[model samples]
Target: MSKKQEPGAAGRATIRDVASAAKTGKTSVSRYLNGEKHLLSDDLKERIGRAISLLDYQPSQMARSLKSGQTRLVGLILADITNPYSVEVMRGVEAACRQEGLTLLVCNTNNELDQEKHYLQLLSSYRVDGIVVNAVGMREAAISTLQQANLPMVLIDRKVADFACDVIALNNVEATQMMTDHLLQNGFEALLFVTEPATVNTRLDRLRTFLQRMQQSPQCIAEQGEIELSNSQGLETLLRDFVARHPDKHKAVMCVNGALTLQVARAMRRLDMTWGPDIGLSGFDELVWADLAGVGITTFKQPTYDMGVAAIGQLVMRIQGNTEPVKDIEFSGELIARASTAAR
Candidate 1:
């Protein structure tokens, strides 16, 4: 009778365990595991295959990765997974990874600086082949550590202040220009660019570009208002104040992002302001609730998912040793017109 070996006390099967169960040496079992079964006799191959099924063996990815010098794993760090924009981008990144036969490990930092730093270090320790970042930015110490790891990285939407890695973001200047023009063309002479604060790169870019674009029309009123990201305490007062100050200027509010858009919309609802008739509204990013709002909201739809896929594409090139200069890629936005921005 042939001897059948059981797994050790660790509750796991090792190559040696499979070998013993197959009535063969570890070398034959290893050869079978590494796709060298043709070197062994048909009887040996059958025995090894039977033993593997009975043992329910799974190889250690870490061990194989150490031997091959490539993990075939990618890391994606997101600032806030709950954001609609982040969710769309994640789907794109994940889909591209699957097509490339690579596994993705996602880390959401919840817009926390310390958490972002922690994930940056954690992903590096995992020996991920590449990383995709979509956070406020990176710290100097964390940046140096990643550089030392020699890991390829790509940024989505947000630029690290000092590090010039490959970037996949929207063309803020052009997109802002487009939105401003659309509002002007629709007869909204008083435009107030609304945002959380001009702190992050994306917000600053849009706010600056909107100011510059609005300057061309010397007679029109161009201004900006800031609101706290998480607070809605005085938002209604802010929106109504903008409209009240410009009672005769055909006023409107152009939010710089989706979150701001939602906030402004809710504020409008609270003030009993019918967007199209009372105050014109135009902004960036698509929202599902926009269509159901009083006279659907007009928004500039960003190609967020495509940007996500492009981020991974750039990272893969670096992983393959492109060795070229860092890349800065931007995508244009599509204007999704609705009743909210109609001529009044």
Candidate 2:
């Protein structure tokens, strides 16, 4: 007699539970569940049916779609889920997926190239209809492999080296230039651009743009530095040193992103430095806490939600067999001036 495993928590019954109840291997259960009952004996079919009834097991749409050859699932890979930028983009992606009646599977790589590769493989195994990726931008080989596999993919904010795809991102050059021009228009004589490692394409673009713009405008002295979030003391030391070097001049810090902006704000607080009059501050992102940071940190607000929606929309077009040329879609970031960059 086959053991009957009962379903728990209503929809909590897994394929493993069904197989166990039917006293069969997972492969056999999968074959039957995918509507290949003709391949199985009547006895096996009756047993599987009885098991499903007893357990009240319902197969997932993805499982059912395996037989239909279209899972209607999209994979979204984020470099770091903790970043507010990623969260905002995800909200838009989720909304678009819901409207399209598709499911989304999200993977957070924590900005690791290896993790990005791993998630790429994982998503591929699930036979996702398409993929939206905000990558760490180092996994060129993996990205190329996926591209070669003919999977529909959209790059968000970050572009992989040598792997051409539809990229939906901010206009890094224009936005960074705008921020730099705004800072120069103010009375700040010196600028310190602080950022994470310029590893990703977007970061690289912004850094390069800032440098180019500053070079064109000799009115301000500009310097770029990289910082890691893991070391607060190092950031503080860097901030202290930069401030100490510009004692007589009015200087401001230009953070690369919201994470760096938070770190700089904290470092300023630790050093008892005030924004405006003495020092000015501005960054790339306008986070939820941006206004709360001292006299409010100045920022360039990226259209993250729209970018997300655009990425998914492009991916869907690709999934539907659109063979048009891949073109990058860029959005502009708005500069929001605040007391952080106010003149003395």
Candidate 3:
């Protein structure tokens, strides 16, 4: 079936067309269109108005924004839009945008350095009032663009290491500390922290805090490891070896994010390992399946939606010309205790 074309997809009216129709120069048409009619005589206004009506001309918002310096658009660059954390953040950002009467434009980087640089440039080109960046890295190209970009940017959940900006993130130190203490209190003495590369601040903080807490627990056995989300076999092997090495010990695995949580859970299943009895499982982002999996996975539930709303609040204020010192806002998370971390 042939698809119908959108309105004005072909041969749409332009200011020049209106000007030609009205027997006036483009400046006169534009001035009239932009409500600078005082600069034009009554005859010019009438001719422009009649020509606009006859040609059904609609002015482009992009063109108007270029001249006015306000697009009423907020740009958002996300790491992975499909991540549960990102999805919640988006909901909050979208709701806040609606309340503030601004539109949202989003680009996903999928945690790729190249894509991050590309999307950063693309969003900057849009002339957004401000940006909410959940950035992956601050490599030279991205940092150069960020340094030169004048619009305000609010970072979410992760920091671009050296750049100073308002940051809205989970209290990683507090959350990870509390969760680690809980695991220790429950007697999960052998603990392994599984994550993707600790490249971003969130992972780095969590890994650091977990290691710190474990160090303080005199009897606790602690280890750190990384998993490639694409390498299920490697994850399974890592889990199997973790159990084999810590034989007869009460063991727990802490995943850094929801996507990794699911990956770890699946890898365990493939190895005929159930979380609660075979090993304790704890993670960061709370996903629905966390409670539905074999004996439910324990998670430190981040206030992702609230973080999103807060990011927009910060961005909107900056767009409104607030030049206060760069603020760091950290939201706290609650641990959802499930049987996944029950005494093993």
Compared with the true structure, all predictions reach lDDT values of 0.88, 0.86, 0.88
lDDT per residue (tens digit) for residues 180-239 in model 1: 898888888899999887767999999999999999987899988889866776787788
Give the per-residue lDDT of model 2 (tens digit) for 1-344. Answer: 45545565554888888888888887888889766889999998888888888777778886578667789999999999999999999999999999887899999999787888888888888888999998886466776658665688999998877777899999999999889988888878889999898878777888889899989868678888898977899999988888888888889999999998888888888889887756899999888888887778899999999888888888889988899999899998899999999876
Cα deviation at 145, candidate 3, in Å, is 1.2
User: Which runs in model 3 stand beyond 4 Å of their true positions?
Assistant: 1-60, 63-67
Q: What residue pairs are clashing in model 3? A: none
Q: Which lDDT value does model 2 have at 240?
A: 88
Weakest 10 consecutive residues of candidate 3 by summed lDDT: 1-10
**Per-prediction CA RMSD (Å):** 3.0, 7.3, 5.9
Q: Provide the TM-score for each candidate, comma-separated.
A: 0.88, 0.81, 0.83
Model 3 lDDT, full chain set? 0.88
Candidate 2 lowest-lDDT run of ten: 1-10
Better of 1 and 3 by TM-score: 1
Backbone collision count in every prediction?
Answer: 0, 0, 0
